[model samples]
Target chain A: MATGEVKVLGSWSSPYVMRARIALHIKSVNYKFIEEKLSEGKSELLLKSNPVYKKIPVLIHGDKPVNESLIIIQYIDDTWPSAPSILPSDPYERAVARFWAAYLDEKWFPSVTSVGIADEEEAKKAGISQMEEGLALMEEAFGKCSKGKGFFGGDEIGFLDIAFGSFLGWLRVTEKINGIGLIDEAKTPALVSWAERFCSHAAVKDVMPDFDKLTEFGKMLFPKIRALAGTR
Target chain B: MATGEVKVLGSWSSPYVMRARIALHIKSVNYKFIEEKLSEGKSELLLKSNPVYKKIPVLIHGDKPVNESLIIIQYIDDTWPSAPSILPSDPYERAVARFWAAYLDEKWFPSVTSVGIADEEEAKKAGISQMEEGLALMEEAFGKCSKGKGFFGGDEIGFLDIAFGSFLGWLRVTEKINGIGLIDEAKTPALVSWAERFCSHAAVKDVMPDFDKLTEFGKMLFPKIRALAGTR
Candidate 1:
């Protein structure tokens, strides 16, 4: 049940790219990582593969190209429907997973990403406040979704895990840049432990970038992130 | 096999709400449509159901609430799974459907909505330009997706059909408000025909709000839509 010529067109430091790579890793699917040199400009392959958005993390399977990180993850799960299922089998659980994943991408990640790069001190504080509020909600969600297990996907690192887990590197980078503790022991006890288990897990151990490296990466991208933040 | 109560928490004029309702109709599921008076502020039930977004078109199946229009549509398809699938069975096609649906929601819809309500002439022209650009891309997509068939689903209504079809009402409203045609016969002849076919289809015919009613509704919400446009 092996796939033929699976490739991921992405840059090294993107959390979105990590989601696709992590999903591939979890499914035990071997894929070639074709890094896009986005600083120079998007690779011709990336532009051709994803013409509409012209964005990174395009999953090239055979000749078909899948765009968007979440869609790519779902595609991998659907294409390789075997052991180590990414999304839950139950209809309701799958819906819940999709709901939370959307929240992480659409709401939570932006708040966290804004904290370190925002221009005004007031904006940074507001970003931190929003990040904390989002964390509290995620904390409650973890309790409900995990059902007393160690991970959001229960024992295994499933959809929600890869989703929120992908941001762990960026989260760490944010914390290092701001000198703050986001996943606090007092506020989110379960997530504090869950983050440790997720990063060290066999599938994710080497996949997540080093904290210091990501912090340096974050510093370099500060002007660019700030410029782009307003556009979003 | 109908087991329990189904209720839709929605405002009648909303395109997103139409998506949930149309998906239900396609499945022949009888459900109560509870009109939320959103102008008076959100109801307690709506807030409780979707605490994060605090937004509408929540599909309450028995007591469980599914938030977000796209998620609700997917949830409905997953829960029913019997006849007339909303999303395609094939994974690749499903991914493509999700991709276009995301594009419509995140990119195209915003462009079209802005054209009529933008405060300045420059902004309005920009909106029209973006709208045409999006329509051109969608026209190309419709050709590839429909594949010489009457609909995107090829003889049946499906995920992309529901996604784009929901917006036809709003597109018409935008046209009426701006006194300009967004879906041009010369530029987007496929979409022009598809819109007619979609509006006349049984599942969509009764579900889409009347054009005049929606036009009046848009006028009433001009100030509100303009205010929210900047935030997004």
Candidate 2:
């Protein structure tokens, strides 16, 4: 019944927003993209769509606004079942897929982002350590999901891949801005290789933001975030 | 293929653990229960099963363990599809259910717990205000989901009910212990009535912990949690 057409309320730099785009691409969902100046304040449309959080990456399907990236991605998958299924068809496998996505959202992403906003050396160090722990867990998770396959989610790109893969560029750029050498091949070979595979994928390559452009954006914003987070 | 057994690694007094129990009961899935002394640092079985987070309410099915309560409930629905579905068959409705569950996890649950953990009166007040905000949203969400029906899920208890309903007792006990009134009829009539309906249901009643014992547990744990959270 999507008479009004599909639209995504998002900004370029957010990994969460990237998820909505990635799912759309994989599902071949043609959605109108609306950018929001996230730092200034949420737009009226964004607020109206997602009044609870007032955050970006709201997927407007016809008149209904679906907030939260994971939920939105699943919505995309559910809405368009014929398109390359993001999650596995098997029940247990689907649960495994969801579990990792939640882990990435709760652990991997936040810890990595913490490195940028935390002003103090100790806090940044803690964040780095936490990120390393999360990465280690993801490395293990990838092994289980792949089990001698190309992607973390078997041969083709799947939900977990989209979940973590969407953030590789932003995570890398943020790490450089924070002046940390996390996610290097030497330290985390498995994850680094996984990132490479992810970037090479047409689904990711077509949609991901340019690294240099993202880095430039990070330079402007990371400092402000650091200030807001306050020095220890 | 569940030759081993269905088991829940959990302890009473946890809304998360309650969710697993409630979901199992609602689905009428017969499962063994393993009581974990979470405060004493997770047991080896619990650790091995759920290494990433190592938290409780892990639903073990035939040796495969599903962590995270929401994921577990969905897993139950998926594994036992013959039973009542926790989520709707319709993709859009399913997405809506997930959105609200995420909202409860991210907004409602945390803000309510914030009241317990926060030390200062100002912080607690802020937590209450946020919880109020979350409840108001849930009120609107219920209206949308119900559409002149009984449950937020309409006609039957479903995912959102399990998500928030599982915590009603814990929330009420915590509120009493903290000496703050949150879910009063005047403030959150819709939610209040929903709780009454949820508790009265055979599926929820059969599995939920005894109220008097749970209240005693909350009284003891609240102060300890407050101290750990660094409050007076």
Candidate 3:
């Protein structure tokens, strides 16, 4: 079901780019992939396409360019109506899916990332607790969104799954490199299960970086984030 | 047309809540209003409705509840489909509107608000320049969204107008209190004109709090935000 011109400018380390990759893969859309050299600064294509942010995970559908991973995923869903629905067709359900996705970005994602790099012992503790709280909220959201189904959109993998799964690699890396147990089976059992299911999903398996490489990246990147974020 | 049941839990002075009000008013949907006083802590209804965030601007349609200002507005758009289109009907256009709305919330909104409350001259200067950059991005977005029309939704006031207009009162108050010129006539003619047109729109005009009262709120509230946000 190739509709011609679909291209994604992505950076391997960015979870956001991973998100766009998984979404496009799920829709079974054929497209081109352009690897961006992040250390060398934004590519000309990236600079021209997403001049505002000049950031990756810019999905180009034909002549138009859509930036932002979540928005791009939705664009893929809307454009490819015949493909499996990334979001539920019901308006209210769709809104619920969107709200949780935004919640993950706002409340959960940052907390998870912060725990991976927090310098001070006290701040790391605080970040852990904050992440726990974020997970609890996510647990509640999953109960509501899934309604006793396999995935957030019922029996199929959907938007929320993709959004949350984007972070699975990073989450594992955080646990490994930081020597912290983030997704404790005791506290966030549902989320832990969801993480296992999501990482092993068919479409997701291809794009996710190898665990060893990701862990190496995490070890290198996290201390830099800690240095930059500062204790003050 | 009257809905079976509708309710809004809001704060009198919250720009986010105001976004909900303007959206509801534009939809011409009949609904109940309940103002939550934050200083006194969360209302039982608010806590019950939105246990996760425990924030206001929760719109209840029948028994179902939707939280987050942007999400609520989109809910209003979807539920009250007969009313004026809150967003462009085209999928691509809708994605563009969503992207800019998120940009305003993420980039522009904070910069606009911070300038009003930044305690140090350096911080204030930084905020002012950051806001200038954000506004520049917005100016570009308006060019694409409006295409020489009155609002971001073309001839009529639409989603982006409501998104930006949510901050109109705060923008005016910031300009008046901070003594900083954000939207100069020569610099952002389109935004300046849009602000004027939005403030006067009938649905928006009725709900926007008085200038004097909002300015007073800014005076009392800003120092507190600076303290809570921390000087670091």
Candidate 4:
């Protein structure tokens, strides 16, 4: 029997949703996944629950919805502290992990979104440059943490690893959609290895959607997003 | 005597810096302040200490420098748990506080920055609209906690108050620089009261920079920022 029912209101194709799912699965927490059709506005439950964001990856535990993917992960960790700790215990390490997580949120997402909408050669160049800059920062940050450590917080998959895990999945699909190879095996070998290791983790592997499906969806959505941007 | 020597590397005009200063002050932590000139690039110590972000509001305890404003606030609260807790103990309430804090970082700042560059007439309209939306969201969040209490956390100033307090000061200055007012006493009575109450708090009042100087600096920098944006 489970302590309480955990429900996740999420869109099928959002990387943020994947983040929460991975954390819950890793912690061995039983959760019911609710796929929300975000294009059709949102459910009343979601709107009422997360009036501020009103977006998915809303984790409803004991009928309370916790919005924001990172916050949701932290909530899960705090609730199930005895289970696998997603964040490191040491304050410094935890801060570093959070910094990377935030970097991914702030820098990486925008760069990738740019890639998704790049039309002209110059636009593609600009987008690629931004993406490379973001990647370089991540590489340097991870290099600092790569000293005899299998994971970001060492010896185990922690917050940074989980945060980047979702990004790597999205990056792969993005590369396919954009027809750009930013993360080749030769380039960013450590990050490449880290991605491999992350996907192999049982918890992460279980929650991951089919890559082929994601690529198909990305291809279908790219034109729509570009059209929307053009209209704007 | 204190267990450790605290040092804060920050710029006087930065909202981010004010957050760290206010957090330390509220906790009654003894700390030295170093104001960095951000235009000349970061100092060697600042770069070395927070190589990742390479930005100010780096909280140095003994030797370790913790970068990022919100992260530093969390560290201060964790280090000095005996004092007024910056975040509520309840996981749900804490999550809500973190969500709003993150929302301010994610949505509010960008919207305000966008407003800053809009054409003079458009700037006022956009600035007022953006600030209104931000204030409305904040008003609801604060109102929820305002029941039977003076502060966001009910009794004493907490994380949400500190996070939002820094914004209030900047918003006021930015409103003056941009010549738009969204936080009038009649429009947002609760938020207006909160800002007045926050500014009057001894800890907040102690660390706040001279508002007139900040307004003058913002006026000076406005055209430069616009010129750079135009070129880009």
Candidate 5:
């Protein structure tokens, strides 16, 4: 049983996890979602599957494990080359899309982590500033990448859109917890609009976790992160 | 009149810049390399070409610009398919290669930057520790990926090897500046051997900048970076 099946080992709350799920859904691929409780020791399967990262969102397709949410999406795109292409056909456009996705993965995610954990008065300020800087870069990059286009790749929701789309769900929670409005109408109207459009897509909407549950989870997790940061 | 010609806008000492150069050389691509003095105001062409990053290693292939060293390499590989393949053809192997390349880009690069700037008292300890950690990870990953093979993929040197190869060049200089030794014969022996084999490759040996000059440049950069960090 489960041989040659597509299995995703992930947690319900991880934004990176959501990315893989969204990609799978968009591509209309059938897969089993195995929710892992990361607080406990990771399962042996998870460890063996992704020994390098030893983290969640490990997409095992036909017995081969692909770690890294963005990479997994690329693997899916490559494996299922059909309608709803997640990346552009043109190499130049593909590079731009990948650059933004990489930017989001590297820059934006760190800020989210900082904000999630920052506690000291000064440290909190630094965290907020970092978050704002990430948002500003995202806004600027999105503006350039989405000139006169609906989606990041124009007329289609590609990998860049899907990659960033996963973060929006978590960002909303982060904004609420931090009491700071990023992606506001004044600050990042285009990004806000894109987030709205992205979340509205049937593929995205169908797999998205309950927002209220996520916010509640964030509320619980934020304090623990802050407490850990204090020890550091 | 260099119409439709390839131009690389980069600084002389940058590892990222060297990545682009190596890719071009390996692919036998004919291009003009424009060295930018980053201390001064960046050149108009560099800024215009990569308006977002406004940094070095902007590869102007024909009429299009590709920023980000890894992205540029991917573009180069795509453009020159018949030449030496940078990435592995197999999907799983390619994903593993991309993962390590990203690990270097996201994790190792930042640690190396911090090492360059940290104060003397803190730098030696923290920098050495960070370097060792990164090296350990690299060694483990490489050992698993290499699987008794000569190179990362097999007999042929591939993308993973090339990406790690560029880092090793800078790492040597950085270690020398910091008065520490990484990739020694005893510790991380596999990686050290890998580095030795990698550096000996015709492609790498031909394109790699002179180590003596790089060391001299590192000596100059270290003080400036330390002074800047002191202020911050």
Candidate 6:
């Protein structure tokens, strides 16, 4: 049960950070979680561990630090080659999973995040529209990947599941603030169900941030996001 | 030795496509290379294989297709777990390689590409400055990664080597057209040497497109890139 000395440097609300935690939890890897107070300033350790990005969700196994959430998850899978694999065993399936995960981070997540931070109505509308299109594509992907199973990993949570599931908390907050069910049952029914199952899963249930708390956190952060948007 | 029936859908000019080719060559996997005539329009097979991105460098083994250059490289390593591994066997090393690869694609490549396409003097200057800064960082990275060895994989070409090396053809073209050595020996001596070794490596020598031909191709593409830049 003792899988090496693992440590995770993260912030409570970062979906990216949650990915590392969720993967560790699923792998049954005991790790010390160090919460970084990003609003104040990045810690020296975080800065040292990831000098290039200076970001969080850095997984330190022993003395070696692995940055980037998806890469960290892959590391977890590789380092601990056990059942409930984070990535698929088959090369083709693994590639497909990675592709979707990349799509979620690179394309879909941006549009969804923009919807929350955009000050202008036109920009927000555009963000929403794009987000909807991304979700529709994801809906089709889920049907293909899941093959009438409960999760993206088929029976249990896998790479793509954690990739998207980590963002569910923020999505919930987005829904509350925007007064729109972003993952509407009629639109993305499978994802709606998958979100519910993902949140309730043993490894995830405890790790997921409380809905009201995240909403409160979002309220404090939205102003800063809007200000950052203006400068860009 | 004959491996599985493998095929690579690619465009000759793409650095991404070259990553897959280089990895395959290193692995000694016999694969049919099908060039996608981008200007002529994407082939139906290319479009079907990679519906999500609709991009080149989709590796087909048997019937399953793996998209994305880095992912395809990982797939090659996974499917062919022999010596001369493309990715470092150690999990931490693999993560570090993946991080640098992502940085090359997402950050460094864009700045370098912008220098070639930017029409405005100020924009081109900005691109060059940023590209130089990126090269300087990469120079430091090569030192840490290579550890006094010949390449990023330390004596043999590996993931980060291919990750950065795939762009050497484009970099050479960029250098010729811009009239500046972006990877200058004065600025990044280690990279300058690494570039020489990488280009001449047996696996890479034939795979790397001819310099003059690529330069001519760049001249044809630069106008289109500038036009695209105007829209963005």
In terms of DockQ, the best-performing candidate is 2
Where does model 3 exceed 4 Å of error?
Answer: A1-4, A230-232, B1-4, B227-232
What TM-score would every model get versus the actual structure? 0.96, 0.93, 0.93, 0.91, 0.87, 0.94
True contacts kept of each: 0.62, 0.72, 0.65, 0.42, 0.50, 0.78
Better of 4 and 6 by DockQ: 6
TM-score of 5: 0.87
Task: List, residue by residue over A17-127, the lDDT tens digit for candidate 4.
Answer: 888998888788888988887667789988987887778889998877789999988888887878579887777677778877888888778888777777787887887
Best by TM-score: 1
Q: Over the stretch B1-232, how does candidate 2's per-residue lDDT look in tens digits?
A: 2336899998877889888888888788788988897667779999899988888889999889898999998888888888477787777788888888887887688887787767788988898888878778788788888777889778898988899888788777767766777777787788888888999898888667787788887667767898876743
Report the interface RMSD that candidate 1 achieves against the true structure, in angstroms: 3.8
lDDT by residue (B1-232, candidate 3, tens digit) is: 2246889999888889988888889888787889888778898989998888888889887778888999888878877788588988777888898888888898888887778777788987888898788888878889988988989999888888888888878888888887777887888988998888898998889788999999998899988887887857
Which run of 10 residues does model 5 chain B get worst, by summed lDDT?
Answer: B1-10
Question: In candidate 2, residue A215 scores what lDDT?
Answer: 89
Lowest-scoring 10 consecutive residues by lDDT in candidate 4 chain B? B115-124
Residue pairs clashing, model 3: none
Query: What are the DockQ scores of the candidates, in order?
Result: 0.54, 0.66, 0.50, 0.42, 0.40, 0.57
Q: Rank the candidates by DockQ, best first.
A: 2, 6, 1, 3, 4, 5
Model 2 pairs whose backbones collide: none
Candidate lDDT (C-alpha), each: 0.88, 0.83, 0.84, 0.81, 0.81, 0.89
Query: Given the true complex, what DockQ would model 4 score?
Result: 0.42
TM-score of chain B of each: 0.94, 0.92, 0.94, 0.93, 0.91, 0.96
Q: Is the docking of candidate 5 incorrect, acceptable, medium or high quality?
A: acceptable
Better of 2 and 3 by TM-score: 2
Which pairs of residues have clashing backbones in candidate 4?
B86-B159
The DockQ for candidate 6, computed on C-alphas, is 0.57
Model 5 — interface RMS deviation?
Answer: 5.7
